[model samples]
Target: MMSILGLLELNFSFQLVSFPAVILKRLTFHPDDCFEVRTPNLASLGQEEPWTPNTLSLRLDLSDPSDPNVSISLYFDPGTRPLGLLPGSKILLHNVEHKISKRKNVYCRFINTSVLTVISFPPSLQKRITTDETSFTRLYLRDIRGSVQGMQQAVCSITRISRLTLRWNCIWCGKLFTKGRCAARQEGFCSSDCGRFGASASVVVDDGTAESLALVEAQQVAVMLGLTAAEWKVLKDEVWMRGELEYSYNQQFHDPVADPLWNVVAALCCKASSFRRFNLSFCLKKQLHHQDVSEKTFQLGEMRYATQLLSSPVLFVKNITPSDWKALVSHWQHLHEAEQSTH
Candidate 1:
């Protein structure tokens, strides 16, 4: 099946030329199979100077509901964004270039000959689309650990946070460089030094099922800690000055080790959000309503019910606190204990 996850696994040679217009014009696709827009247009290269030629570069985060674990950043050029494109909107892209960056991030670029169709659903269906896509993409850490393909979302608690390190990558070839030179120069590519500062770190997260290590990039680190890049730099400096930066991170908001039970939605390449609880009692009740079900059958039914609840509109429990997370964890533990006792 054609999916964002599938695209990530496939390798394509780098090409600057666009596909022929004749081929693009004849292509057709179903709206349901098309990738849904997760985030709106983002200026990938920032603002262009007056003297510089107009590039009109922007990116959109798009994912297919069939494979919600993966989302691709699509860059647009040579034209303005399509009208009526918004989050939850579906888009069918044709003749886009797929390239792997220096960070091994897979993304698509819309060239001059690319064709894009913005598919907007009805007002009633928009919420359903968003809920279904979000729920499908969100999985437990255990479930996502073995997946070798695309980015998977999980609501996990920070078990451990590592120290941040400063890194630089070439803008032209997107290659990492430490010495003041582009490695791509040896391969006859651009020798010009176009370095950009980036912060990198890893964090261990647990979602009660399993623990997994997740890498936090520059932008995500700032968002996950509720701080801007500049603020994070200042805090890092302070921590470095204290001579404790090698072992621990400064607790400006909440200590990751002490307050490890956070409700933030974490993914490989995404920002964090405020804590929120999800109600699964209705799902349990619904599953238990079926009488005379075998233990195995009941367990299967419970899983189905949980999935249904996640896809439902009323699943999100907003503005939840750390204490609420503790209570929720205890409640789950009790439920598991009761189930074991019954067995």
Candidate 2:
């Protein structure tokens, strides 16, 4: 297996070789470059037009297994792009072209004759890879407010949901529009006429120690609510009707109307035994570790730890069992109480 570093250092072109790497990110291709040519209406009249095969240009950020720190951008011009290509996917590149661009950036390109293979790791190996890449620790929302960063795991409750906005984006040009025609079509750049609807809502979450606002993206919201975009649109009237009925019930007993339409929806979604506890992973901008602070205590003990407020952090929410939630909560409470006593 060729290493990405060694591949870049090659002075001459080589062939019939393979390199194993993990994908870090998928870059977007230009609308014009990936768009397919539409068959003209005059073709029905027996006017033969030259056929142009649609081609794909995909760019991926890859890291070599030999040296995870070393990463490089690779461009693919394959006849057909592989499906299920995502970040953290392992792949093997065969007979790729190594070239330096005008900006002096070393990158690899996969030509028409090149081959790409998606490889899967064994269950044991996959677990090991995840453990090696991630450092897990239990922390409260208050402790995470400043002292920690990077990927954080926490359990929080939704206190408020607001600013729900729904919109659509052109699949080709990725232009966000409320309604009407896509900008790409107006400019004659795209003819696919494909668009996807997405919705976002601002939510305030509480974990006892502190409350923070998080902007839940379309995917997270959909997963948490167990409702697709289409379902959300279809059930809008029913949801409002249910909300009004609940409000009337609360009024009859003189109870507080704390749960609104979205709030009730969120609460009902979480009522499922599986969704009782959610393991949320948040990617923070700044990176810090407790061991680093301990090691450099004398050098940086007096430094104030500033809270890095989360601004649209990517969240991965997973359901955890009640026993697991209890264990984590107990550990967090003990630590939080100890810290509070000292202060």
Candidate 3:
């Protein structure tokens, strides 16, 4: 406990590394198949020394008695973390054989203490969970070996607590991560802002509006880039909230409504182009790498002709010859005038 408080006060941090060694000793209670561990010798606490035990404890003790007032206790299950110990390391131990007879079970007596400076995961070739892969927790275990000699209880005494807080961390990013904001919110990103890259990504969205918008925009962008419905669907739900479109439309009707008007204008514009006769060959010869020609890539072939007129997009100014814009407006005006005459 003294050691822990001192560590907290000093803001001590250690570099953890894994190395292969041996468990010199271990004591298992055959009835429950659990083990108890303690410092095996005094000479083993050297820097970079590995920890070995005849019996490994389910808990570890890390209190110091040099000063008596401030101390701390931490409890952990076996296989909770990879096992390695360097000089200055602490361990919490529990004696399961000496539980008190009461409505509640209480642990007592000191087994041993290890003088490891650090603990860390052991190296393995198996790839850990990464963000690019499917999001889920996969099980893993690492073999660790280190040597440390624990001191006697008279040197430092620590009382065990009923429970300890365990941190849940991101499997990929290795930071504190959690779920549940309010009762109303659904789970995914820790918060809505994180979903949108807005703030620090800590607030949760109770309503699904933000999520729905993101999904729709991803789908629309997929369409504009010539993606199939199935292909778009595969990536639809994987976008951020801020990237969503500002408007909403019925998915069933959107395709039918937007296609015709765009097609007519695009066809007229393309026909007016010097390259109209080469349209089929031009499309076929378009650089596939540069072309958004997926099976469902947006069918905006007509608009392609019109966009070609715009230049200096940075200036928001049309780069086409004045005659081209004038012709387009005049053509629209003529259509309007003809419709009025018919009416």
Candidate 4:
């Protein structure tokens, strides 16, 4: 947390890429498996890294949702967003990334944490959404995993949290990297704004009946593990550079034997003791991965986050504090202005 708090005082500039795209669409995409979108079209995106291999596209609704040319196509990757979106719904898009294909086609891409938000709630039924994770009726992992079920959602605690990404972060800034750059320089980065390193983390969620492997990003790990992004960065830096003990944000400590973090998660609606509980809404999906296939045969990883996070918190860490994300955004805007000045 000190790393982030220290960042705020630095007055460093960040470059923001896009504003929120609010559009009304019929909610169309490829595969039409769940019949979510009424109208669908063939897509030619998501054929590379940082993009879903089988990405699909949706049209941006304009001119009362009847005119065709008023809508532009937006591409999305599967399992990285929430499901249960109905047809003919108007929605808002945030944290969306922009890309251009080799054919010069514009692609508005959404990866993990990209909310395919459903905003069709009626005024009468429009209550404030709860921040709590949803609880599932099926209490065991075996029933949910081994069932011949259509779409299933459950609430489960995190049995084992992974720290592979946190360990492999940048030595100085402690930021993790994707392609060649760290997240700080993801869009527009100055030499002084950030550094880069490579890492990815996943968690094993066990509901006693079975264990499912979840593909996780760095931010989610900090939240569930109960440390601010800045603290983790500093803790990682001190451990790697200065050879110090782990730092905990909530508890304010620098101890070697103790892993400083909170062990509880909830907003009181469906609270459980020990680890945090989350509403896991997902269906059985037979996804095709290139490496998973052995000798030209298909492979399955059992039941996993082919399910969505059901618009809830997973671990005790709810949201990254404003200082964490907000500081980054503001930093980027300054960088954008600087780049414009040079041009």
Candidate 5:
């Protein structure tokens, strides 16, 4: 049975009990077998109201001097999804409807009539938050472009694809390769020579608070080229394989308009009021604006600069080509040509 300290009569059908107030710290659903949420009962590890076995209630920081009341937890039934409830959201609930379970623990029911409002994260309250590793109370998107200057880590979503991505430049001359043999190398033309076309492109993703270009690397290009080469070889060898008008590599590579799958991918990556955790390093420095942004945006002076961004991938990618593979092939080809000249 619920050992309530006391209960007071209310105008509503149910009585209102004066329980300690609390700020929400977390609301997660972990599958039990397939992360199934168990029914809340008295026999649960801690005889707490509004918590099932799968809720796994642990990450809370309750030292707010603004409202110094004891912390309490709340639970919504499986089907009931509170629209705006999030961690750090303050709620005032006059919830009180007692029911006794088989395990003899008193369960407090927070029905729909309870007064709950989700408050936006208080930006000024950031000062009260410590630099604790496990603390989620601090950090916002606006401050992220500055706060994450050191080796701070935060979760973010990969939101939009950047057209400026996938630029292929000559490894030697380091110029945009549109056409013409690269002066730096003999075989591959300058990346600029390829024009503004590529299989993989850059993207902008954000953790709820801060946005950055999701980390890009040279290998992403190699993945695209490798896929193209594989598709080309397959087409050359196979007699019965159906011919594809567009290259197979094109399936994964497309503009935001041409391919809609990336839009779906972006949505899947975002969790409402939740983010994927990543260990990351960040450095803040002003960089000269890109040609695309420079032309589109107005500038005050010739030396216009904005924050340049880069990040590493938490997602694993395949190693389509090893670093030394190209160097070895180029060396052997040059040596073979030298021998032929001597002959």
Candidate 6:
């Protein structure tokens, strides 16, 4: 009898009030959950309105006839994505009405649906991305944490603190190197020679016409300055002849042998912004003048004497056919000792 009475009471309560069933599919958002609603009766509630033009609004319908306030929560997945649902968007809604009339009976009803906008990250495939450093770094971190924990353990045996030094390995040539000036200074490219690119014949120019000859000579000078042979030959015969009249017969009209090409070579090798300073300094030094000074006064000139240039160890190093850089080192060593003895 008591169970029957309880069932009847539940039925009566359900008939007066009902909750809408909610289903979340392919869940993306998780933070935006709580929702609130208030109505005098169910007949006054309305359907939901769209939140943004890009987003669809969610709606919840109530089954109760009583005008009661409601508060609810919802959930979805949260992962980072470029577009679609972000961290903070909103929800929209209005009211609805239902009516029933007949010859023998009359009734009125209120109904409504609430609108909700999604706010959270969506799952993506980028989570699987890995790099070598990151992977090794994670392993290192794990081992370090374990080691620290072991050191802190009360029952663990204490070992003498031996200072193990740091070390690194080169990525390119696969060589082990100790922690020192070479490893700390360079980015694991064991030596400058290892990173140096081999010299190749870069550009070929026409050899027939007088103008072609001039262009070739210009290109040869530029090659001495470290411009690629192909690049120096880019200004062809016709262009050279067009500007040829500006040069004079007495001018010698060769690329400046006045300065060691090392300055030009290093200037071009460095960054673009610093190029202007080099250009201005080269221009002010009268690099194009080609005037000859006596060999006796060569060492006394403003560092541009042709013999001084010809004697430069850089020229001796680059122009020779020797396979070893040690030959150049040997030549400089003799020259340095000679200079010291004279002094």
The model with the greatest lDDT is 2
Candidate 6 displacement at residue 179 in angstroms = 61
| Model 4 bad stretches (over 4 Å) | 1-140, 143-153, 167-193, 196-199, 228-230, 236-274, 280-343
Give residue 291's lDDT in candidate 6 (0 to 100). Answer: 35
Per-residue CA lDDT of model 3 for 216-253, tens digit only, reads 12222232223467844433232121122111111221
For residue 260, give model 2's deviation from the true position in Å.
Answer: 15
Worst 10 residues of 3 by lDDT: 204-213
Model 1 lDDT per residue over 121-147, tens place: 213222111231133333443333122
Per-residue lDDT of model 5, residues 215-331, tens digit only: 334434333223356743442233112111122212454577864444433332232211222323333333222231311222223633233233322222222222231332233
TM-scores vs. true structure, each candidate: 0.27, 0.33, 0.17, 0.26, 0.29, 0.14
Tally clashes: model 1.
0
Per-model C-alpha lDDT, please?
0.40, 0.49, 0.24, 0.36, 0.34, 0.22
The candidate with the higher lDDT, 4 or 5, is 4
**Model 2 alpha-carbon miss at residue 151, Å:** 0.3
Ranking by lDDT: 2, 1, 4, 5, 3, 6
Q: What digit string (tens of lDDT, one per residue) describes model 4 on residues 1-343?
A: 0111221222323211223222434354565553444342112111211111123544343222334334444555433223212223344443344455577644455544333443342122112222223222433343433333554444344544433333344344555432334445554542333443332344555432234555445465445555667865764554343222221222332343443321221111112221344444444443322233222222223412232221211222222211121232233334445556787
Tens-place lDDT per residue, model 6, 253-328, is 2354743232333333332321110000000111112232224222222332222211100000112111121332
- State the lDDT of candidate 2 residue by residue for 219-270, as single tens digits: 6666555566786665444432322222111222222375345455445433
Candidate with the larger lDDT of 3 and 5: 5
lDDT of 5 at 24: 37
lDDT of 5 at 38: 35
